[model samples]
Target: MKNSTCLQPSLATTVALPVIYSFLFPAGLFGNILAAWIFSKQAPTKRTQYVYLSNLVTANLLICSTMPLLATYFARGHQWTYQSVVCRIANNFGTLIMHVSMYVTIVILCSIALSQYATLKKNSDAKHSPAANENFHRCVLNKFRQPEFAKYLCIVIWLTVFCITVAAIIRNNILANAVGEFHTCYSISIEAGKFTSMLAASLATACFFVSFMTVLLSYYCLNRHLSKIQKNTCIGEKHLIYGTVKRNILVIQIILTVCFLPYNIFSPFFYVLLPGNDCKKSNYLVEIKNFLNCLAAAKSSLDPVIYLLLDKTFKRSLYGLFTKSIPEHHKGKADIFTEETPDI
Candidate 1:
């Protein structure tokens, strides 16, 4: 039988993670911070997309916040020198941040779907009364679309994620106590740890499918609505709207798959679920898990880049930061989000 020690990841095998972290930590820090700064400079608008985008930037900031500890962990060759409690907190906080990012992205896509529906209603029913149109607008964009709603939603998400993080931290600390080690944390080793890891993986798998479907449904609805308008509108205008919406949709899909899917799908396999010991294979599996873990971290940084590409307001704010003097007319908050992107 292969020796159990051989199953432990070697320095060579572990090298990739710290290298990834080296880049992710700096990039995520710069990008997320810039995103937050840009969002801060803008005033809250009546547009529902502004609320959703704000929440997304907040989530991205949380996700990026975990990188310093992670970079240090990998820098030290997989042995966490921090206290066991700190280790547990860091790991679980990372989990909390990831879930927040996932849920916010789902909400953003769903809102886009809702916007598409509203546009269809307005376009198809030209004879609709002014009162009826106002009612429709309020229903679609103002019921729970206010900055106040976003504030409450974030509070609820933070509370829920906090509970889960605490539970995870407790479990890890309990296991660390049982093993007579109070300086390191492992995701899977004993029966309890394996069980917990599997449970988390199951949850992540469910989220993956749900979010993917939500994005697809949003894209389909938006495309259908755009198609209906193509006949009446100028060809150039129709194609521009269609192309921009499609581009944004594609960005959403790429980020969702690239960041979350690997960790969700392969995390379960990292545990030795079968009866027999296979240390060599197990080690390889764990290495893959770590690699995916780094990829997941990359999303926090990439999200800000997405915002820069897709959000005209955010792009202007970002551009304003570097330029010493913006024209007096361009500096106002109201001017930032007024660029028309058709129905998007």
Candidate 2:
């Protein structure tokens, strides 16, 4: 993504990114660590969900780990010599890992949506629902509901993403363009390759869209199916299940919209605009791309909070850490969306 002989430090590179990354690093790190600890304490019945969530936490931690190096390079990479090892690790490897982690999270989010939908659909009363719909749901999403299957699925996702990212890195660095001296660290964005960079960006954007649409569809079906049950039931707080599921779905929806959507929306355009552009346009594109990337990284920071709010075990564990008192009324609350009607 080199545009000229040397890039001058802009406010985006020097101030905005460093400040943003500094905030993201510690916040994301602490949040994900807490999430990991809570997940480890989950009961064996939650093994399926633990598989999905554990992988998600791992990805978030990976994203946070890269932030410091990225921030440091942006803050003062220019002062360092061009041959410094920090430059390669910060711009090249850091960016690659971040991309891989982002994609892993995206895929896992989609899996969560499908998994929850299947669980709900299977548990829904069969008399009111079409038999074919239940059969279809079981046929498609039931396998993913198993803990062993989910573990394998996550492993495959990681390996696939890792391979794709490594291939792109090799192609971009070794095949697309010769290694050029970068006088300013700010200009050392993870792009120097031409076609391969575009391919990587396009693939990520495509993956995001597919996952986003899948999540939206899952939410729509769950809402449509569960709303009926909520309406007909004059019994206990069955609505609690509906509410919890609805809120969790809403949280993920918001997270996806806020953190992942915008970056993916505009990233493909950067590669297209990179070629044959003047220095001014190139710099602007780089700034905009990097800024959007920062927003995407914020997903890691936000996911921990999402888990804390929507995941009951995480919330309880966090609460217990601060205080030992447990309320009598809260002693036997039912699992979210699992028990449609508590044995009242």
Candidate 3:
């Protein structure tokens, strides 16, 4: 018999994983589901970018829905008592959804940033000419009048994500057979090959670093532009436009830094430093690392909450959820505390 040191999860892991899974599974699933629903009700012409966001939320819900099964596996002493095929399927599905969700989020974040920048540029251009303003408004109206492009983009994104996920699963399964594990799932043994392990670590590190830098640079440029507008000598529509852009950019930056960046920095280090051998202390470290990863996954759920608070449309949807009538619908028409518009 080959000697092996399989993980024996600690009491803390046993307790913590289930608790974390409970919170994550329900919150992520319901939050994303609600986001999708609200998005469906919105004017399709409002923001085509939000269609990508809706797909992201759906992917996140799929990923988080699998957490309970993973938690169950861990609870069973990290053993594969389940059928080998079932284990592989579960693991592959969970991993595929997670990776797809993450990459989709990265793409959507970049898209949203670029879209906002473009919108700002368009607005800036409109300031110079009444003719240009009329032309732009006409274009906007025409763009919204058709829904074909948005529908095609949404379909393409879904199909692309699905194809990539399937390809990864097939490739991993083939690789698993050569690595002496027929029943393996998402986790590749780091000890299988030092070169392979190092390569994986390097790739993960590079991706995280690139994403972090991209988001940071995008926001830095946006903030500098907004600051210039704030310091501008003229006051008018540009001021209101710049203010809205600045506020939205600030909120996005804060979420990326505080909620997302910490986990990205932590994950690669955790994967590299933690050995495959299941020493008691090493297992403890792995548990802590997994908890941090859970925190990272939880950020998807948090993103929509941030949107609800920062974006007026989401807030209106939230209010619509809790109240029979949306307060915004009654704006200026009803007797209320005041006829003042709420600040975004």
Candidate 4:
């Protein structure tokens, strides 16, 4: 296939991508790296969720840190001035990081939903009898005494993503052969390769859609069950449980739908339109594709911000990092103690 005239990016996009990349990449990379460090320092406990969350943060950081490579590529007029091997490596790694990040998020979200459901179910079972309720609460609390299952799941998730990514890299030679005369790196022969591209993108979209639906359905069922319980019982604590769970689930769902859904929807369209017969007409579509690709990268930053907003432990840790001062009274007491103590 004859190469189509490359579309010139608008000044607005040229400016926006770099600015967004600069702010998002550094901040997100730093934040998620800090989060992973913090999580690592803590002794492993039954809190398997934290393990998964940390892994997700690590993946996001990896993705965000690669944005500068992309920015540099675009800044040079979409030319891949880098070596062919480096270009392929960067592209493949960036893509792998993104897929890993998405799947990690999906796993974490599902875990949260399942945890909430189990908690609610235990509460419901306990409501039937005082003795049974106490025992159930004890059992629920004790469940957190072992982190083995969660750790195993996290390992499995990462391994699965790794295998899938390796398979893709092995099967796709386009990344190796698609460099233009100007050395601009792109996927191969879009018209000829449209089927493979579309197939891969469709599978990704389907996975995302399925995970999204799982989250939505789980929340709906949970809420419905809570509502039924609320109608039957007049316990004040019940309201608190429902309110907290509802708020967290709602925020997560909203972010997933708003920040991530557009990329999923537009990506397949971009791939399909890229190699169509109407080259001039497809220019705008290709531009849109590039824009969406950038948007997907930006989600790495957005995910950490979401964690900060929604996860109380993360918020507290971030706050502690930013706020270094102790209370005035405590400081004074410490100073006095130091002065009075022997020089040991």
Candidate 1 residues 112-157, lDDT tens each?
4444334433433353333655676546444444456655665675
lDDT digits (tens) for residues 123-187 of candidate 3 = 55444443645676545433422235544655765566566556655665566566655332213
| Global lDDT of model 3 | 0.56
Query: Per-residue lDDT for 233 in model 3?
Result: 38
Ranking by TM-score: 2, 4, 1, 3
Off by over 4 Å in 4: 4-8, 42-44, 81-86, 128-146, 174-183, 186-195, 321-344
Best-fitting candidate, scored by lDDT: 2
As a whole number from 0 to 100, the lDDT of residue 108 in candidate 1 is: 53
- Model 2 clash count equals 1
C-alpha lDDT of residue 69 in model 4: 65
lDDT tens digits, residues 248-309, model 2? 66667777888889888888777767666377777677778778888898889988777765
Candidate 2, TM-score vs. the true structure?
A: 0.89
Point out the higher-scoring one by TM-score: 1 or 2. 2
lDDT on C-alpha atoms for all candidate structures: 0.57, 0.74, 0.56, 0.59
Sort the candidates on lDDT, descending order: 2, 4, 1, 3
Error of 3 at 27 (Å): 2.2
Model 4 RMSD, rounded to 1 decimal = 8.7
